[model samples]
Target: MTNLQKAVILITGASGGFGQELTRQLLEAGSRLILTDINEAVLRQRVAAIQNEVKTGEVLACLASDLADVQGCETLYHQVKALDIPIDILINNAGVGLFGRMDEIPRQRWEYLMQVNLMTPMRLSALFVPDMIEHQKGHIVNISSLAGWCAIAGMAHYSASKFGLRGFSEGLFNEVKDYNVKVTAVYPFFSRTPILQSERFGTLAKTYQGLPEHMITDPADVMRATIQGIVKNQLHVFPDPTANRLHLLQRYFPQLVYWINNRMGRSMKHG
Candidate 1:
C-alpha cells in the first residue's frame, strides 16, 4: 500500500546470478534481507560476501532448500517463521531455462523446470499472499522472461513456464491491487547469467548469438529498474530497452513478431 520502511524481504535462489545482485542492491537500499538457495555452501559464501563488503542491514538470513519440492517449500516457510520476521517483499526469481525441442526434452527434466519456474513461485505466493492481504501491504516480484511474450524454438518448456508466470503476475495484480498489494512481473531479455551455460536435455546450446557485451544485461541495471518499479508500484518492469520494444511490437503487430522470430531462428540454426 505504501513505501516500505525497514522492509523485511525474502528472496529465493539467493546464490543465483540475478539473486546475488538483487541481494546487494536491496542491502544498498536498506532492506532487511532473508535469502535462500538450494546450494547451501554457495549461499553462505554469498551472504558473507555481502555482509563483509556492503553496509550491513537488518537480519541477513540464508537457508538451504530445494524450492522445486513442495516439502522443501514447507521447510523453508517454517524456518523463516521461526525467525519471527514479517515479510514485506517476496521475490520469486529462482528459475531455469531449458533448450530442447518439446519431444527432445525428457519428461523428468521438463517437470523439474516447470516446478522450479512456475510451481515454486505459485506455491510461495499462495503461502504469503494471505499475510500480505491481512497487512494490506506487500510486493510480489516475479522474474519472468521475454520468452513469455515471444516464442523461440528449442525453448518450449522455458517459454511455457514464463508465460504461466506472466499470466499469474497479471491476474494477481488485478486481484490484489484493490487490497493495496503490489505485483510486478519482470520480463528481462537474455543476460550473462550462468543459466545460459547450464546443460539442458543432455548438452549445452547457445540459443542466441551476440557478443557478451550485447547479449547480456547488466545485473545492476536490472536490479535498479526492478526496485524502482516496486517503489513506484509499477505493474510490469521490462529490464532491457530492447525487451520493452519487443513487447510493444508483439502487442501491436504479432505477425511482425513471427516474421522476426522466423528470421532469428534461421540465423541461430545457420550459425
Candidate 2:
C-alpha cells in the first residue's frame, strides 16, 4: 500500500473536471503535487484557485504540457525529470472526449483521441516506470471509464481507447509487482463532470440529459473511492455503485448492455 502523505505525485490534465477535484483531494491527503495540462493559462488559473487548500498538499510544480502526442509526453517527462524530483505516484488523468459515429467523426480526431487516451499514458508510463522500478516503490493510477468495459453509442472510438488503457494498466500491474510498483485502473460511469458537456457530432445530446439522476454519480464520490483504493494498492476500482452494477452486468450480461447501446445509438444515428 502506498502512503500518500508527503508522497510526490504528478498528475496530468490537472485543469479538467476530474483533474481539479482529484488535485484538491490529493492535496488534502498531504501529497505534494506536480500538476500539468495542455493549456498553460488554464493550468495556472486552476492552481491559483486552489491555493487556499494547498496548506496540506504542496504544489511542487505546475508545468503545462500537452499529452496529445508523443513529443508532448516526451517533453513533459523531460521537464519533470529535470526538476530532480522522484515521483511516488503518477496519475494519468488527462483525457478528452469524442462523441459521434465512426464515419461521422473524422479519422484524425480518433487518432488524436487514441494518442491522448491510450498511447500518451503508455508513453508517459514507459518514461517513468523505470525510475519507479529502480526506487522499488511507486503507484500509477489510470482514470479509465465504464465505457471501457462495454461499448457505448456515439463513443465507439472512446470505448476502444479506454479498453486499451484498461488492458495496458492491468498488465503493467503484474509486470511491475516484483519491483514494488503498483498500478490501478479506475472505471467511473458518467458523472457531473465537464466531460458530460463534451462536444458532440451526429449525436443525440438529449440521451445524457435524459438519464435518471441516480444513474449519474458525483465526481467527489468517485475520487474519494479512488483515493481509498490507491491507499490499499487495489488493482481495479469500480468507484460508483451504479457503475459497479453496470460493470457486473456488462461482464455477465453483455448482450443486454449492447442492446441498450444499440437502442441509444439508433437515435444518435437517426434522430
Candidate 3:
C-alpha cells in the first residue's frame, strides 16, 4: 500500500471542483503538495482558505499556468523543478468539456479542448516521468472520464480527448512500472463539477443534466475513490458504480453499445 503521509505530490487543475476536493483530501491525508491551475487568483484564494485547516500536509506552492500549450506545460515543469521537490505523485486532473454534433463544434474550440485535455497530460507526464523513474517510487494519476471507456454521442470531441488520455495512461503504466513507479487512470462518470458547466456549442446540444440524477456523482466521492486507488496501487480505477456497469456492458455487449450510441447520435440530429 502506498502511504500518502508526507508524500510530495503535484496536482494540475487544482482550482476546479474535482481538483479542489482532491486537494483537500490529500492535505488531510498528510501529503505535501504543489498545486497549479490556469487561474492564479482563484488558486491563491483556494490555498489561503485551506491554510487554517491544514494540520500535517503542506502546500508547497500554488503556481498557476495555462496548460493548453506545450510551452505552458514545459514552463510549469521548470517552475516545479526549481522548487527543488522530488514529486512523488503527479495528478493530471485538469480537463475541459465539449458538447455538440461532430461537425457543429467550432474547429478552434474543439482543438483548444483537445490541447487542454489530451496534449497537456501527455506533455506533463513526459516532463515528470523521468524523475519518477529515477526515484523508483512515484505515482502518476490521470483523471480520465468514463466517456473514455464507453464512447457516447453528442460528445465526440470530448470522448476522443478522454480516449487519448486513457490510452496514454495504459501504455505509460507499463513503461514505468519496471522502475517501481505506479500509474493510475481514474474514470468517473458525470460528476457534479465545473466541467458540467462547460461551454456548449450547438443550440440543441444535450447536457449532462439530461441524465438521471442518480447518474450524476459528487466530485468528493469520485476523488475519494481515486485516492484509495492510489493507496492500493490500482492501474485502472472506476470511481463511480455506473462506470463499472457501463464498462461491462460495453465489453460483453459491444453491438448493443454501438446500437445505443447510434440511436443517441440519430436523436441528437433530430432533437
Candidate 3's displacement at residue 183, Å, is 0.7
lDDT of 1 by residue, 1-271 (tens): 3354588999998898899888888887778989999988999997888778787565458888899988988898889889887688999989987776788778999899999999999999988888899998888989999998987777889999999999999999999988878898899887878887654553224444522356568777877787888788788889888789889999999999989888767676555
CA lDDT of every candidate:
0.83, 0.87, 0.87
Q: What is the lDDT ranking, best to worst?
A: 3, 2, 1
Error of 2 at 39 (Å): 1.4
Model 1 TM-score relative to the real fold: 0.93
Q: Report clash pairs, candidate 3.
A: none
Off by over 4 Å in 2: 203-212, 259-271
lDDT accuracy of residue 234 in candidate 1: 84
Per-residue lDDT of 1-271 in model 2, one digit per residue for the tens?
7899999999999998889888899988999999999888889888888877566878989997978888899999999999999999999999888887677778888899999999999999999999999999899999999988987767889999999999999899989999999999999988888887667666444443434556578988899998898899999999989678889988899888878777755644444
Candidate no. 3 TM-score: 0.93
The parts of candidate 1 lying over 4 Å away from their true place are 1-5, 202-213
**Residue 177 alpha-carbon offset, candidate 1, angstroms:** 1.9
